[model samples]
Target chain A: MKYYGGCDAGSTYTKCAIVDETGKLVASVTSRSRINPVLSAQAALDEAVATLDDLKGAKDLAYLIGTGYGRNKVPFADENISEISCHAMGVHVVDPSVKSILDIGGQDVKGIAIDADGTVLNFAMNDKCSAGTGRFFEAMAHAFEMPLDEFSKLSLKAKNVIPITAQCTVFAESEVISLVGEGKPMDEIAAGIQLSVAKRCFVMAKKAAATDSIALTGGCAKNHGLKQAIERVLKIKVVDLPVDPQLMGALGAAEYARQKGLASAKA
Target chain B: MKDLKHLYYLENLLQDANNNLVREAQAGGRLAVGSVCSLIPEVLLSLPGCFPVRLRAPNTGSIDLGTYYMTSMSCECCRALLERAVEGGYKFLDCIIAPDACAQMNRCVENIDLLKLCDKEKFFISYSDVPMKSDETALRHYVKQMRIRVLEQLSGVYGVDVSDAALRAAVLGHNEACRLITAIGEYRKEDNPRITGYEFAVLCTATYCCPKDLLVDKLRETLDELGSRQPDSGKNFRARVVVAGSEIDNPDLIRLIEGSGALVVADRFCFGSLPGRQEIVLNDGEDVLLQICRQYLAWGKCARFMDTAKIEERQSYIDELAKSYHADGIIFEQQKFCDYWGYERALGSRVMRDDYGYPVLSVDLPYAVGTNAQLRTRVQAFVESIEIKNIQGKVTR
Candidate 1:
């Protein structure tokens, strides 16, 4: 009857995951950009507790782990781990064969290369620019006056895609508007946008030597067009797990907490 | 981790050497060269058996030396330079040499040192009369004072028997190293680049503390081996980029950038073009160390040292370097926690756009190896933007 809880507070969104002793995903929740991370973490904790109706009144959680950008800010967590390590561990838990994991979040993108045991060998990240991240796509969606879900769908329909050149968010927005004015089809423009993200991701993947089975996690992975575009350019099929990709970081943190808890008990 | 520990030890040794050199120079009553462009005078000090250390702060510390200056001391680099001097890091020196190369360095001497606000117990202030016109008479006078002061200092510390032959050889050795580094830089400009700008900088800085013979031989071998390696195919680069920022010490970042098919042709970092070029010439039997020291103090354009109209001048220099190198883009790398270049970010970006009509990418780097994917994406997209499609005679869309 042991219980484990995890939290992942990212720049754009915060996520939480709960798993039982048998590794069953009991409950998971995610909140958008507005809430403060401390509050967001509480919301996620509440959601996890609510999912376990029979164990709702159970106050005895075996272990809790906090991770991601705001892991240190999580007050209730028993321990904390870096998102870089947690993401690798979480992805490996889902598919142990995944050697390379590319996590594209709202503000940053990371490429992690891991060993069979889920230990990070070498990793690279991109936080300085927003061109290749979820934020870039969000900005593009805003310019097109489309919801993110619809935008991804429309992108798949483009007969001819026109590439946007500027890496800057402001400049790229203008380029999209100019393309719209030139009577370019919407789907093609969307495809071009996906292409841009893919190009940046490809550069990172090549640097990390994205070898063997690769996992695509993070908020951007939900985009069908982006996933397809990345797969095509990399010339490799990317594995997506059934568990919510956004929650993987938190799950890994929880798993780490569980292991530490068990080791201390043994000691 | 072992390499990092080794670097830590090396840094400590440099700091110790700097302190001892400054103390010996001051005790012997020699003038210190403290200008960004005072390479000649710095060399002269070394040749004359007097110590010449660049006034810089330890990479970490909380002492606010710039607090003694006025509110107008907004240039963080200039403020940091003054702070280093005030922190008693330069307490061992006999004289503080100030070159009038830049406005900030000039002001630091006139306002900070000349005002007698700094700790004056250890050092005197000597200003070089190197006019913008490069006056020979002024150079001779400065060289004479340098020699007399250094000789007096050597007599007190290690005795006056310091051989002129040994000093000349040291000066020639350093100058030759600079020549070899410059040659390496020239090699980087080829279509199929052999070495990177950051690697070239490492080779240059390693020479500062490393044995002269070892460095010279190692560099010669590296250059020969580099020359034999096949060049990167010039076909893939969507755009050529010039990288500028604080000294890029991370080899991983450089490899990531290069692997993205963008050749870095020029840079404004400490480890790049700065150390390679030889701008100062030493006169025979004219105290080679002093000549080099004075030139080192007078050299401007480093972000660390501020000069009159330096912002505009640096922009122009970057523009010219980009044009000469045929760079298609420019990446402005600003290290996190470095307050000096953060202020220059906006202006630097404008300079790249307005002056050169090139796309400028601003990268804020952390100490850790992060930002690889994001940088790759930004660079690739930039190249893809300018990608040209060749249309053969058929059209059907």
Candidate 2:
């Protein structure tokens, strides 16, 4: 019953996933990534481990790999692989045939073209722009004084979606407020916001030539409206992975740890 | 992986900016004249007792003050350099010779002048009107302008000899620096390069910090030290890459790119090997100043050109280097909000991918490095993509 740990200290959240040698998810945890990412990752891992019946702490793990933005910050990790590679690995494990990935994370959106074996063929990420990010949606939700889950659900209900085209999140938040003030329907504005994000993501998708068998990952993927908008624009079916999309990076890190541990064990 | 001796010496020279090389040269009774663009021929500055330093704001934290004069919409590189000028980073310079190379730079010079940022008695600026086009008429005007604007002015002001004999020595010394740098670049072409991209950047930047004669001597010594060493296989990379875009003085971004398992073997940009470190070929009886002006005009990599042929010619420079260096991909490193490169990168990426048949990773970032994690992810993905393609190609074959 060998096991490995994967830590993902991202911009907004720190997540850790522990898996058995057979690639079974043993336990997982997520929490806000504070100023100190190292502590956040450690705490997340500890909380996850505490839930396990047999395991007491990190010492029980065969290998602990790290991924995401603060991948190198996790002192306990054996190696730091980029979040891009992690995402590919996690998605490929779920559906090997999936060739394209659109991961709109907390800060930015990454459009990736990959092979069946989880190797990236091409990729593009937005620069200093939060038009198609979780933060953008969060800000919009904050403006509406509604829970993010409800706002996402409301977008799908819009029949006559009003077009709002502010690229910056700050500007778009204000635009959303102004639209609400002008008696524009909330569902319509939400739909427009989803459309805007979908459009922003497509530019990067085009760069990577991500046209088919798309896998939508990241925390933002949980939004049904945004997913449908991306599918409508791309004209491709977006598949949902077996594991929670938010855990993709951590899962990939665990997979890498498993592979590397096996190789080292053999040597 | 860390015991590269030559890199340590170069890193020391790169890290400490306070009177390490420039002021050391000034203490030797040599005038240190700083310039903005590589277009300012070294012969003009390196006469008898003068050192030419290209202004670079290394480890620049913020341009909050610089944006006050030039709006935040201006190019990050210009704003960074302008901020350093305002922050007294360039106060040690005798005269900052800014060229009217592009609009952003012109704005930077304008702001510096309007603000009267530096010590009036010790510091001054020579805004040379560089020729935009590569025509014969423009060439003549450029040569004349460079002579009057930089040559005659420096000679008159600094009280140095600008004779043909002095110019010839400057040419040879400049050529010597280029020769050594090109030799260093040639090492990168190796299957396992002894020099890393960061190390190469440090070596390239050393020319801008120290006198050519001093740099050439130091480079020669470093080459000798490097000659006895074997290439390290521990740092085996996934694919070889070429860095192409606007001027790259800082190696932090290059270090990040290299960290992603891509070995940067070639560079085609301002302040890079394509033109800057290319050996200067002095013709038989041709004027030294004219030859330099022609070289700078022909080899200009900035995106400010209106002429399509000139842009195509520069594009070929990248293609040829990529082909020659056997590059797997190109990283289009542009500073954020560079109006010229914004257009250039869009057009260039399309042409490079479609016509030239080379993959390009376009990155627009703040001038500083290690701040952006998204950038690292992109570079990593890019390398993985290139590697995956190679594997896919092999399987298909």
Candidate 3:
């Protein structure tokens, strides 16, 4: 059996995954903070290789593909693909019915509409601001004095969500603190924060004019409240895989590697 | 401020200007000869007794600024020069002059003429058909035509003789100003590094039409005072940065960057470095004014101009400066509505990183008041990342 490796070096974290030719995720690893993408990518690749130690001696470990904000930093990769194409490819590989993918990372957010063959048809990205990404939630988490993981869960329990006015994170922080001082419930504030992010993402999705069955990726996808908020605003069903949401870029990269390997073999 | 003494001073200056005896006295009793750009006409007009200022826009930055203007993009240099003209900053001028260098600049000339900043009779719009690659014959013809226009304008305005001697004297005065500027710039690069680029730009702009002797005296004093200052002795300086931006005249941005622990060492800006040391090389030819004009058009890289070779040249210049000055990074400031720098963002970043092996942090400035705190955070984060990279032994080419 042939094996392939994929790495996604993002602004906040580094992720790696290994898969067989059949597209089964044999192993994966994730690390905190992506200060130096090249070094982080090397470390991630080593972890992926170590996870598949049995497959290390496999004769047909054909290709390595890299993608993401820091995709160019992955020196060991045989090829590099755009994160948008990779994200759409990964979403389609897991769920072939997915027509649109909304991937929100640390610094940027992108909404991609994919064709049947997993080609990127249309896409819109928020490159200018951080309000549309997981950074918004991270800021809110900091404001709440809670871990990001716990904050994600807390957002789901709000009964009466109050809306935050500012789209900027700094402005929103002052607004959030003011509301908190006024005796607003923490869960309600969390719900409002999720709603704000959803609103911003909705604008991006609308710009891309994404079709039905949108799949969410990135570290923010782990937030169930954000998922619900997004679904509520867009009036569409959101899709997810069993693996960690952050692994989507790596999964997409591996899928690209597999497709390229098979095509080259046929040639 | 509007006293007759100022007028008398200008009149006496004009009188001294007419007599070759005054020129000889100023030049240590010799014919003072120098060169000046065509744009010197405008600088000349801002004086009390001279004709209008005429200038040609160098083609560059047109596409980027045009995109911002959209339906009004016109030509890049034309738009930039016109925008500056329309700002009414040169209200002191008797009139402004422009040449039909390009269609866009011609349009700009027409638009500027429509504005009532100065006397309409003083406005002289000359059309020159000199090609970019003009031959000797063509240059001579152009120079003759230019001389006629200069004589006519000077005679009409001040009733002074626009003889070769007088023109030569004016050119010499301009050259002396240029020499002082070049000296100051060279002095800044030495052990003390006295005057900053900002102060240098101010001195350059002020010297534009001011009497050569006055400018020289002021600059000499300034340079002396600056040279006497001691070098700053400090370690743990976070990072030395060169800030390049469009219209970074706003001191707030500088304060914000400095507050973030980065020392701004050099810059490529209209209000910063371009105005200083852009000397007119006169000894090469008799048509020194036109030569100066061409040199000014070709001298530096601006958002309003496009020259890939020049851009690379400037990049290398900055890189060398950064290395010599021990700079850590480069901060590119792109103002909103300034589309040229925005389009160059990705390419500029790649060049700085790939070719020069230096990290670049780009900040897009909005016209609105107040700087974005998020941008400040990002800058801090980038600095921290650089520090981390150094600590981890990963900093490399």
Per-residue lDDT of B128 in model 1 = 47
TM-score of each model, in listed order: 0.51, 0.87, 0.48
Best by lDDT: 2
- The Cα RMSD in angstroms, rounded to one decimal, for candidate 2 relative to the true structure is 3.6
> In model 3 chain B, where is the ten-residue run with the lowest total lDDT?
B29-38
Write the number of the candidate with greater TM-score, choosing between 1 and 3.
1
lDDT of 3 at A75: 60
Across B237-260, the per-residue lDDT of candidate 2 in tens digits comes to 888888888867787777888887
lDDT for residue B312 in candidate 1, whole number 0-100: 71
DockQ scores for all predicted structures: 0.04, 0.55, 0.03
Q: Model 2 has how many clashing residue pairs?
A: 0
- The TM-score leader among the candidates is 2
Off by over 4 Å in 3: A1-267, B1-91, B97-167, B187-215, B235-237, B250-252, B274-276, B303-308, B367-375, B386-397
| lDDT at residue B388 of model 2 (Cα atoms) | 58
Candidate 3 residue lDDT tens string, A171-208: 99899999999998999888888888888888667745
Q: How well is candidate 1 docked (DockQ)?
A: 0.04
